[model samples]
Target: MAVVFDRPSLWQRVRPHLRGFDWLLLLAMLMLAGLGLLAMYSSGYDHGTRFVDHGRNMVIAAGIMVVVAQVPPRRLMQLAVPVYVLGVALLVAVALFGISKKGAQRWINLGVVIQPSELLKIATPLMLAWWFHRREGQTRAFDFAVAFGLLALPVGLIMKQPDLGTAMLVLAAGLAVIFFAGLPWKLVLPPVLIAVVGVVLILAFEPQLCADGADWVVLHEYQRQRVCTLLDPTRDPLGKGFHILQGMIAIGSGGLWGKGFMQGTQTHLEFIPERTTDFIFAAFSEEFGLVGNLAIIAGFVFLVLRSLMIAADGPTLFARLLAASLATIFFTYAFVNMGMVSGILPVVGVPLPFISYGGTAMVTLGLALGMLMSIAKEKRLIQS
Candidate 1:
């Protein structure tokens, strides 16, 4: 016993706790981190202070990832209810007396002006997973409805704040939980059907509903204009459609092999807006071209696949649901950024995960990655 207690190797202690470490996932995460740094450096070249700020955020994010990876899923489950409740309360706070920015109030100052919706991005899934896990083996239709109500509550509040993008993200994260919880396909099909119909209706009547200088139903005028601009960017080439046009030009200008790094005329000339944030992909594409785009896409695919594998191997229902939701969230972030940069979607404020320059988003993504490591770690422990 004395021999065992004397100077035990650090690996011995870490080995037992990290039995579920997925080396593939770790490698994928590291690859993404490297890509993030490269992209940040290139994107921040023209903007002083941005490059250094991005580096600081990266370090903070890495530290968060390490800390989150250590927490057991069981502890995550325990914190779910409180986190959700607090998130809801914060959303309400945002609705009332929140900080206004660019014609939207999506923040509140609690010694700092922070976006509470980001917290819900993580808390919503954790809470819903806990709820579904509680009803395991006996999940009924009403229970599912109640679960959706729980899901919709925060989404409704977020949408009320007119933060359509974050609201969609929160909604997606909750639905992922519902899907992983094995909610009936019948229930799922209806909402999807309604959404399709709603989109079609919007497009069909877009001209009358979105005509210039017309009042919109609930969406801000700029939001409606963004959608209209997506359909016909050429109509207002030098106006609202400027962003889409510039992004498309930058992407298309990059040939099969690209013009070479930092050689993009549009990017260097500052045609692309938010080059370090939402539209950073355009800068990357301009610099690296098709091959670079493929590489970035492949990296994203590997990350998503690894996350799904982790979800599949999680030791508990909560871990599985949380992992799957986070995986989809990662996919959403990539999809929105790519879609906007390629002119297929509206230029919302969605940032490219890990690569975009924002401290809150960086920390949020880090926390998600950390949770993934925790789930993977638990799975490894079970396997051994």
Candidate 2:
């Protein structure tokens, strides 16, 4: 008689790993992606292949997310410095010999046009999270100062490129990490208060501050115009105001239940500018109405909340900060896109996450979400 032993099959061996997956987050992402596909199809009807391309991008992003989730947080922290250095080097390269498109030199020609700022959106937060993680429990005010310096270097370079949208995203992501790392309120409040006061002053004396030939001290002429347009789009009705006006009109017309999917007059009539990109929110609002808007908002809320919960349960300080920061990135994208489309914020070219048709943004988002998944999985593995 011979004793025989059977080895476990591949599926059986891999099944344990599958148990660590976060289904809730996966569901929320799928819901948002589905809604995005619907919106892109409607908004990009006349734009040849946009709907298909958007789907392709989503698939690619999902694949990136899956691949990234497999890399544990420790490995991610190890790569953080290298990634940050590469991103900054690319930004410097862009400054010196970057490709210029539409009056903005924000991309580098590496056989393909690549936006370096996009890389920093994830890398900056990762670097900060890793930095604070190394100094966990012994962090001082001086450490925070060093972190801010780290944050400022890349942010300043991106701002010089004059890509306000990408700059704002990176700034928000870095600030989220700083805030989660427990930066004192005294340090945080002053800048926020100053920003509020500045906004009030700008609105109070819009006619003067925005008057012709008035040079805004820190903002470029176009940036100043965007702020002024946000305050009063009607001032430049046929010029800088057109996009805001059309967006507001589309949103207002959506009413309660939406005009019905693919039935938006503003969208189909081509009145909404950048329907496949920055202003896609208007097209969505017009067709989906208030109900649809609420649904999409709910999806984003779930995603953010889930990520925050993951951050709260993260096993390491780095994981916590990184997860929270990534969550804020998603919230910032949604809020800015919606606010700008509704004429309440400046038109900074921020695209609605998932819904907007953009390759770089989609890839960045996928990476952030993947990192969140990695943190979540790490926590799960520890608990098990």
Candidate 3:
């Protein structure tokens, strides 16, 4: 008897791929993005086109996530070295001939203005993860030393650009990779202790350290002012402290429920600086109040927890390290931004991951989320 063969249709061929996707993670992301849109609309109501532009950015980010998620983790590992090398080279180029804006040489012009440090946010962890993966069963102290050297180069270069916020994110991401790679706590505790002591010393002698013509040897003049301002914003209420003071007032005024959507007095009256960007959380707080803030925090917590779960189930060391480090990036951005706006931390330019309105940051976040999805999908496929 002649055999009759039947070919699977297009939908059937694609169905297996679709089934591997992490729908729960996508749902969590959508929830956060929806909340972000609501907050952006309220904060940017008077600002021209900000709400529209933010929506566009989110759409672009979603596209990026979808495309990136299709790539397998092994292919991502292959790109690690090239990406890290190119990012570091661009940092060097920026040091030589970058565009200077507001006294910071952070952007490099290559037909399009690009911040190379942003690349390192992803590349640092990727390179470190790749490094550890190569040494998987044979990891040694020397390997970690090399990893630290690789990490410090870009971080040092970015700090030279004087972008503290980006530097912090990069540093935290790199450290997360190192920590997850089995770096001993004995090595980690010393740095933690030193940082704590340094902060205490700076706060105890703020008046002297912040006095006129006093040069903090390690920090720039403006950086020193930021630290002092965080300690006591009222000292320069109308000058250096204006942003923090206004942000705190807007947040405190929110009370239990809030003033209602688009009804923030501090935001409407132009008291909150960078209302649609770095300080948007203040406007969100004023409009949505404690309940909204808690909800938003819950959403972020869920996202972070979900990402960590994916990392725990990652099929390889590289996948695990990369996923965990990316989770830390999300956590650090949220923690630092909220702390800065609420007057507990020094005001740096870090934007809240999904809630803040910015194209580059949005795209970077999408890339991180996409990588997580890729890792999760790989785990699911392996199990099946």
Candidate whose lDDT is highest: 2
Query: Taking the tens digit of each residue's C-alpha lDDT, what string does model 3 give over 148-259?
Result: 9998999999989998899999999999999999999999999999999998998788888888899988778888889889999999999999999999999999998989
Q: Which candidate, 2 or 3, has the higher lDDT?
A: 2
After superposition on all CA atoms, how large is the RMSD of candidate 2? 1.8
* C-alpha lDDT of all candidate models, in order: 0.87, 0.94, 0.92
Task: Count backbone clashes in candidate 2.
Answer: 1
Q: Which stretches of candidate 2 lie over 4 Å from their true place?
A: 1-17
lDDT score for candidate 3 against the true structure: 0.92
Candidate 1: C-alpha lDDT? 0.87
Please give, for residues 130-190, the per-residue lDDT of candidate 1 as tens digits: 9988998898888888988998999999887788788878888899999989987887899
Output the number of the TM-score-best candidate: 2
- Least accurate stretch of 10 residues (summed lDDT) in model 1? 13-22
Sorted by TM-score, highest first, which candidate order results?
2, 3, 1
RMSD of each: 2.4, 1.8, 2.3
lDDT, candidate 1, at 144: 87
